[model samples]
Target: MATAAVFLDRDGVINKDKGYVSQIDDFEFIDGSIEAMQLLKAHGYLLVVITNQSGIARGYYTEEEFMTLTEWMDWSLADRGVDLDGIYYCPHHPGKGIGDYKQDCLCRKPNTGMLDSAGKELDIDFANSYLVGDKLSDIQAGQKLQLKANYLVSTGKVLCEKGAEAADGVFTDLLSVAKAIVNG
Candidate 1:
């Protein structure tokens, strides 16, 4: 039996999606995000982050700057007693990207590269894992990987629309997702 995990999409799901957020001041953690992570952690689920950061590929920011901001974010979450197990990001875009980043990458969302890597490296049971994200691509990624559930959050770019049928479940915010995960 492999360990289970909760894969999270960083921008929009954990933090407010403020377009290529590269600074500590610009990184705003969404309400209840920390608590939700805490809940997952308490339940013995490894907390992992799989995100697409095309901003780096677009030259909006550097990888070093993204790491700086990520360090601050990790500190913030640690202060709240929620330690993330790992974070994986793909800085690639098929278009509008520079040089090495111009190619399509498997680690990007809608692909299971990150999840597969995390599963292999961290011993995660893909069939027992769950994913929470704000985009249809996120759901597709989890579905393709056969995760236990996928919760599409209506907090940022992927707002909930009537008759927009895609995800296994939908929530208004990360807090709502947490409630469903914990209560069920």
Candidate 2:
């Protein structure tokens, strides 16, 4: 049977959005994020990370560096008793990407490519899943796939009024969202 999932945005939503966070030293989990994942996991929600890493296209970092940091993040989360089911990222930037990275790809948010890929690969039940992101694009992406709900959290970059209005719900952070999901 397909599994319900909680799709997460990496930067801003999970970790502090320190611009171009490609190094372990720069990765800092937002307060309560780890706990949020643990709570979701305990409730049987598969955790999947969906992010836009345009910095790779901009040459700020390489894919290898990103992978290394991701490994560290996975390990850290595992140590804390949370295991992410999958992670998908878009390294393309239509205008600013360097060389091969400069393409308008389907994997970027608002396009639903990454989410679609996750659905197929992970056997995700889109109608039963939820998405939590800090940006409007993230909510848009989830909306396109008709997920159970899309939430915008305030712990990352400053959220604009429009972004707040676009989400199915808005919360102070991931933990709040998790609580809402688990309790309901």
Q: Judged by TM-score, which candidate is best?
A: 2
For residues 81-114, write the lDDT of model 2, one tens digit per residue.
9999999999999999999999999998889999
Single out the weakest 10-residue window by summed lDDT for candidate 2.
155-164
The ten-residue window of minimal lDDT in model 1 covers 158-167
Task: Provide the TM-score for each candidate, comma-separated.
Answer: 0.95, 0.98
lDDT score, candidate 1, position 138 = 86
lDDT for each residue of candidate 1 in 1-184, tens digit (9 for 90 to 100): 6889999999999999999999998988898888889888888889999999999999999999999999899888999999988889999988988999888889888998999899988999888889999988888899999899988887778455531366778888887887787788
lDDT of each: 0.87, 0.95
lDDT agreement of model 1 with the native: 0.87
Error of 1 at 143 (Å): 0.7
At residue 86, give the lDDT of candidate 1: 86
C-alpha RMSD by candidate, in order = 1.5, 0.7
Give candidate 2 misplaced runs (Cα > 4 Å).
none
* Alpha-carbon shift of residue 91 in model 2 (angstroms): 0.7
Q: Which candidate is the best by lDDT?
A: 2
